[model samples]
Target: MNRTAPRPSSLACDECRKKHLKCDSTTPPCTRCTNESLLCSYTPSRRGYRRRKTPWDSAKTAAAQKTPQHGGTSTSSFVLGDMDLNQSLPLKPGDTTPPAPSGSGIVPSDAAVFSAEAPTDTPQTIATNRSVELTRQEEERLVHLYYTHFHATAPILVPRKRYATQAYPAHLKAVVHFIGSHYTPAFDSNLLHDAVEVLLSPPQESTLHTTQALLLLSIAQHARAYHVNALATLSRATEMAIELQLHSRDAPVRYGGLDPLLQESVKRTWWEVYCIEGYLAAVHRQPSFRCNSVSLEALLPCEENAYRDGLEEPQSITLDQYDARFFADHSVAFSSACYRIEAIRILARVLALTAATVDGPDDIQSVDNAIVAWKLHLPDDKATAIDRCGDVDQMMLQAFAFMHTATVFLHFPRSELLLRVPTATDIECASAMVPASPTSAQHATKAIVASKELSDLAALPVNKYSPVFTCALVFGCIVQLSACSAHAHSCIVQHRDRVALMTGALKSLRRHWPVAGQALRKLNTIASGIFNPAQSKQSGTSSPTTHDSGIGMDATMGDLCWFDLFPPRNGTEDFTMFGTAHDIWPS
Candidate 1:
């Protein structure tokens, strides 16, 4: 039978038809109609035969009609009529029925729905937990990467030996070369971070020996970082070194007989670690932990143990032995000097801070006493001790001079100290030990021993290649001399000319001296300029002329010149020389 096709359902509004692809048809004002531009119409429909209520529906209706077993009572009765299309649904005979709702908006019964479905046998709890754990592990890995690579490079100095067979070592070496060659004040932060990272992440396949080398590089980089207070970086480096040392000790069969190069690298690493630890401790005003003893013990097999007998003697070893390379070979010297300097600096800072805090006589005396003791113990000939140990004999003289000058300044003001030691003049003499300026070729050709010594020092790994360390040495010496000269001027009017001479000499050395040349030329120029300006004038380069004209051919001549230039102010009188001819002469 070809029954008439059902009229195509009319589209409702565009939105509903587009979304559901359903049709609605009701006349205007019809039950489905709306005044808003919604389509409203209903096609004449052939209705399906209505069936009797299903067993579930009959049960649900009966349940709704029955009184609740609980104390609660139904407020309204369910009305039975033409089986409601939304409610009449078939169900199995044994199904426990849910009570029919009295009105629309009734909440679904979860228990009834669960009862209708069979209980599942499997559970997903374990899978859920595993997913969570995996997520956490991933997050932790991300954090580790952020710290080790993003914030700062791990300060892991992988040794060249570790990468001997691989290109990674070469890449790392190149990286270091780039950093060292191009390092500037602006690049310090970034370079430091990269250096630390390279140190921390040596290739996994690297041998223990190579790893130790890389560690050394890391330590050196960290030491450089210390100049700018990258304390956390330095601390990490030290920790890494300690860990590597421990690992090496435990695996002697594999790493026990490390080559001298590795051994030296390890020693230097510990030395720097110890130094940085001490410095950081002192800066924080905490008692520095004694890493020196531990380091010394670790390095004993590799070191000469030169000062074992005099370990208890303060300042027994002169500063001349404190070269950076010495630490590479002789770890004891390195640790000792590192500890000593740290202690000195810390104590000095404490005294200064304390003096500033309290103005009483006792505080001043306490500081003064401490200063005196420090001066007495300062190593002579040891201004740059790490570099001078090789020539202990020659270094001893410089060490002595340094100690004497340090002693004078430690007790007196800068001016009074200058009068006594006049190290600025000595610095000029010391400068003669360096290469002469290009402008002074004639002086450069001079074969002075001091010049040779300075040249040797410049070539040494301890001072020559390390610009940071060298700058520290130069500035330290200048500060000591300047302080002495300043105090000397404050204490004695008669010593004013001597102070001026020292000041002029220091100024000349700092301004004119270059590290490339021998010391003799520098000394000759400085001495001539200070002792005999007329001679310097004849030589073409003007002596650093001073306001106080207390330097000339003789002490008497200088004194007369001083008076002529600076006539006594108010009640002050011109300073007069009172020594024999030799006493008045420049040494």
Candidate 2:
């Protein structure tokens, strides 16, 4: 075979590059390449060639090339206040008539322009209407209720500025009223649904205002048992965040080109979507959207004050760094908002992997490590206190509850999964027998512990994270009760405490979330069986008791809504989508 002699070149040969070896700048074949009979080629010098641009780079370039709209100004330069009066119309859902005049009726000339803009009213137009139904004082009250209750955690709405003359979108105002009313007795269920209908008309180009309004609307819908609409609204919110590229690291640099505060708000909005989607997935028992730690390039939100004060150069840290210390330590390095965001990020990761059945021991270990690290470095002052009932304090407490809930969720198997396995040892007697392995028992123990911790926290007022924590805490309590039943003789010490904790948590949760009410009823039925063994069987199985006493017909029987111990009769609804209003809460 003929061998080519090596020639000197500026670049390494393909063979050397593949081997990760020092190249002698050989052109024909390096000595190793020639000796090994391998193909050796150098990349040609590129005096004329241009490097390919990435999709993001192209997007940036295209954005730069676009002409300024509404004069020689970028889109970011336009504030909510600068919107044209001709665009205002407050159409109701499904109403075709031109919407009722927003705020003050548009001036005659502006009215003609509005008519020219659209002769016929559509749902989108209704969303943009600035008609102020509430008086200034009433509006201020509603706004106060919102800021007092939700603004801290959600923080989607912009802060009110003194002497500013901006027209707030009708849908945005409706959403605020809807959410604020939930905590107050002034609003009923209809008010919440009506608020959602405002945003449901149609999504309008995913502006920051629209996204914030839609997100809050989704939460309200979710709380109102409108799960399908909640999911749909959330999907739209997520799309808006993505369209804005809030997921990218340079999102601040790109989207915040002019207003850094707007950029920070965008980051929080994206993560808020991230957190919501994750919890929604767990509740729906489906695969989560792809907003994991790896895919997330944006920074975890800075402190609330930082965003509010419009700090010139907002400092930020990655979720990993936040988890490492920023979230756990409070030495002015992090905020409650950051803690909430980070907690959800972790929960999202755990739920995403576990739902897909892709989580292995290492993944579980990673979650455990993060939780342990957080607990180890948790600030002493920020600890969960029973007396702290303020909104911010309650949020702090709820964050801790969510962390525990995530732990229980990670380790606990779904009821359907367990039901299908059909262990020879009865579930009612699970504590009597040793688990298949030590690891399994360890997981169960950890889950029970987390559940108790969450239950303890549920003693306080419900926070937004309450719904998720409520479900997890109840599940944990049931598991603990079952264990006590299984080992009746050995687990006597904490049996009363476990029962009280489960009942208390359920009662507390029911006061705020309707779903908790259903869980409470089911728990009461199960509790009846476990506590009153004389009237039933020692094992709390669905099997009918023997009725050894042989009751007379004179005794009046009470109504009992038996919880179906069996898994779903059909596959249409399983443990995955178990919590929806239609499905009813499963065991």
Candidate 3:
């Protein structure tokens, strides 16, 4: 420190000095500033003159850099900052970048629509760089698809009524995007964001927009495999409905302030959210908002046309009486859509209690009994089994799938499962001796029979409309595949056909859901190992050795699965599937 005198810097301006470069103190702009178009300054002793360039200069510079020069030719060139850029140069045949269409609202950017994440262009990403203002026809098509394919299964919104209205709400807009995105391969999160924004905004009317929006958001998130976010969005929606007392039988159905049609819509909306929360809980193997109690004794939603016409009103039934009355109504008056909702509700309870085996056998038996009773009470003509009747609507099929899948899920791991089971159970507990006798192979055959029905459904060309198609197919395949794997030598069923059924269904679903794709890839490796163990061993295909559920299996069996239903015990201390198992659902 004592010997050093500071060296003088050659650079003059702050920009040059920052870069640690030598500077020529020219009177005009310095070479660095001139070349880079950065501001130039000199010392206090002298003034500087800087050349000004028009916006056209910047445009020309950008165009020249971006456009390829195959031949020495001049075409019309125009400034891009003010308008869409155009170049008169005749582009060669194989040009990758195309000019923006007039009024396209697209902005030039570094990010390509067909990026590495998606090598091929998709309908969603076709206008990625553009601001999308959905046309009337496009909206109609999307909404129609939703009504035709989704309404029967979901039935949250009065599509016919909502469609006829002039006043469009944000939640409706959100639903449009949600449905559209399913058919669209490359989804954009911004559309989801706009939906959330509108949903979260403070309400000004009696319309159930917020709740509907939240429900749609949850559905979109779930379909796209954003499970955690979907759960959170669902929670918010559930809370909103709770605040509105939408679940209460006594709450006024208001359109604006007091519209009965609006009331019906609200009723449907609340139940839909209830059903969604339950479905999410079942799929993820977690606790959901227990609707069995909570003083929410609202009657199930009526038919859509009935609600719209204000032609029907459901008779009020107490919580205790709900099951008997609901299940008994197999008549034309019952809303099949609502019937599906109740079925899903029952499913959610089963998953919450039996999924991780956090509860005892009594809890399992109770729910199992309920499921059995539900099946028994089901109208024989309406579809007690997969092929009982001809020409079933998509909604009824969904109900059947849910009912069957719930049965398989309830008995899983409790009875000796033969095929790929989700990794959500405590194997040590599962293996533990219990009082009830283990179900014999004949008893377990119930799952096999139900699974066959799912296989038949899988073969249907319009199987996509059934919302529970994937869940049922996945669970059913697990049963069949497990049975085949456990008794490969003794199994009479065609192993190849069963494998094909599972893999194909999963592949079809994978196009829309990444989770399905992941499951499919996993199932493929497992099937390969099972069918050709010698080849699999030689090829060195890696199968998961450890089960997430802590269930241990032999190496020879290849890979078995168990979806992680419960979070780690220490991870969530306060979690409960509502209160005690006794308080879950009414008998």
Per lDDT, the best of the predicted structures is 2
Model 2 clashes, total count: 3
For candidate 2, the C-alpha RMSD (Å) to the true structure equals 20.2
Candidate 2 lDDT over residue span 1-587, tens digit each: 99997643346665565444656765687777888898876643212101233454345445544644211222321111221222223343222222222221111111111221452244344433322234445456667777765676566555545112223444566677666665666545453444336334442555656666777776665655555556556666666666666788877656445556656766777777777766666555444454453377788776666566665775677767764564443454566666666666677666555544333677678888887666766666555533234443534565676677677666655222232122212334333222344476666667667766766665555544435455555555555544543343445457547667767766765655666677677666555554554454433343332232221111111222111221121223233211232334421
lDDT of model 2 at position 54: 44
lDDT digits (tens) for residues 1-587 of candidate 3: 58885543333664464453556645457778788998876422111111133665456555555543211222112121222101111111111222222222111222122221232233322211222344445556666666655665566665565554423343455465556556554555445443333233222123356567767766765555444445545665666566667777765343323445555665677777776666655655454454433566666666544654554444343344545565454443455565577688778766566535365657767877777776665665544423334544555667777777777766654444522342223343322322144553543566677677677767665435433355566667667655654454546246558667766877887665555665566556655655555667577753443332222223433233242322222222333322211111101
List where candidate 1 sits over 4 angstroms from the true fold.
1-175, 178-229, 244-254, 257-268, 275-290, 293-295, 301-463, 478-484, 487-587
In model 2, which range of ten residues has the least summed lDDT? 104-113
Kindly report which residue stretches of model 2 are placed more than 4 angstroms away from their true locations once superposed.
1-133, 160-167, 250-261, 305-313, 323-332, 355-363, 379-395, 414-435, 463-468, 489-513, 532-582, 585-587
Model 2 local distance difference test score? 0.52
Q: Which stretches of candidate 3 lie over 4 Å from their true place?
A: 1-131, 184-207, 255-261, 288-293, 304-322, 325-333, 352-364, 384-391, 418-437, 440-443, 463-468, 490-496, 542-587
- True lDDT of residue 282, candidate 3: 61
